[model samples]
Target: MLQVRVSTFSAKQLVFSNIDNEFIQLAHPRLWMQRICKRVGLPILSPHALRHTFATLLFSKDVNIKFVSILLGHSSAAFTIDVYADVY
Candidate 1:
């Protein structure tokens, strides 16, 4: 099992912010990722790719499938297995 740190913050706080410390709009993170990838000479990846990678990594680590499904907001572990069977 993984242990996560617990912190207290306001419900309205932004998880990510712009350079000026203002709230970031929905598309800002993807645009920033594209710009950074171009600047660093790396292939641009979509947020969905990152999410898939995260799931693959977790599956590789032998975490419980049900737990991973919950984290990914899947309706059931069977769906997660069906989607990521290649990872296994």
Candidate 2:
């Protein structure tokens, strides 16, 4: 099992924000990623893809399925296993 130390952040803090420290519109990051992918000649990817990649990477490292399920806010470990059975 992988041991992780989790930290809590302020509820008022925004993970993604504009240069002015204001809330970013929902489409802003997607548009930015699209432009970056176009400039770099890479396939366009969505934010959800990063999330799946994160979970996959964690599973690849032998992290417990229950831990990952909790991190993903899944209702149960079985669901996580079902979704990522190929990873393990």
Candidate 3:
């Protein structure tokens, strides 16, 4: 967690506020994230990092790459394997 501080009455708030109860797009609030990390002590997260973590966690759980590839919407399981071979 970035552990960012806000002056809310509760002393805890979701910094990267969301809208529409939807997932955040990769480029959504990009500059805001950079500025927040610049102020906080957290490293800048790459756009692919979340995807990479999803794949890596699946691999760690012994999930088949073919299933993961299908879930990832990749053209082929082989391509997914190729891209995340290090995690395997």
Candidate 4:
């Protein structure tokens, strides 16, 4: 949440505004992911995987699925459950 706030609001005044995207660009995230994967020698992953991790962690904590779904901006809790039945 803080990250989102910083990216959306505080980022506007930050000096590192040279990048094309305001907050985060797909290229940077992709390159960063690639660099990490190379350093760790793990399978490739996209930034979206972080969202899945968040949902799984929330579900493991027994947070309400509906709330989690909403937090994820998912269309519906049922959709979230379908994707994370293991966590459920």
Candidate 5:
């Protein structure tokens, strides 16, 4: 619940990156995720996989394809349906 609030009010641009407070490199989150996966005993998942999962869940809920397409930054709804036709 608190996580939701922080994300809602705080910077929506970068959740992990603190440009003003800390200097981060590309390898930071990579190593962090590796440690987390090791501790949780789950397969490592990439950002792309998470994004796909989010879209799949929204489609499964019968959300508008055009809305999903917009959220995904796609050029058009037809392309979204073309890529995710199986879900529809």
Candidate 6:
């Protein structure tokens, strides 16, 4: 058997914890997203925008739509093509 060793650190030392203690609790995805948007000086956008952005970027990079659909957990490749064909 192969062995993998992991290092453990206190929550205080974690990068996510450095972002916000509130992240320690399960809150809205939008809350953290809004924080990031504001920090970057962009208009506040829903978390879904990130998914759409990923799909659009992958399309621009010429990654296959079927692969993108699977990564996005869509049930059908045609659905992915239908939804983002205009952007592509």
lDDT of 6 at 73: 81
In candidate 3 the C-alpha lDDT for residue 44 amounts to: 89
The residue pairs found clashing in candidate 4 are none
Q: Comparing candidate 2 with candidate 3, which one achieves the higher TM-score?
A: 2
How big is the RMSD of model 2? 8.7
The sequence of per-residue lDDT tens digits that candidate 6 reaches over residues 26-59 is 4567789899899999999977898899899999
TM-score ranking, best first: 1, 2, 5, 6, 4, 3
Q: Between the candidate structures 2 and 5, which one is better when assessed by TM-score?
A: 2
Q: Which residue pairs overlap in candidate 2's backbone?
A: none
Estimate TM-scores for all models.
0.69, 0.68, 0.60, 0.63, 0.67, 0.64
Candidate 3 residues lying further than 4 Å off, grouped into runs, are: 1-26, 35-40
Better of 1 and 6 by TM-score: 1
- lDDT of model 4 at position 58: 90
Query: 1 or 4, which is superior by lDDT?
Result: 1
Ranking of predictions according to lDDT: 2, 1, 5, 6, 4, 3
lDDT of 2: 0.81
Worst 10 residues of 2 by lDDT: 3-12
Among all windows of ten consecutive residues in candidate 4, which has the lowest summed lDDT? 2-11
Clashes of 6: 0
- Candidate 5 residue runs with Cα over 4 Å from true position: 1-12, 19-31
TM-score of 2: 0.68
Alpha-carbon lDDT, every model: 0.81, 0.81, 0.74, 0.75, 0.77, 0.76
Give the worst 10-residue stretch by lDDT in candidate 1. 4-13
Model 5, 13-75: lDDT tens per residue? 464665443456877777787788889998986656777899999998989999999999899
lDDT comparing candidate 4 with the true structure: 0.75
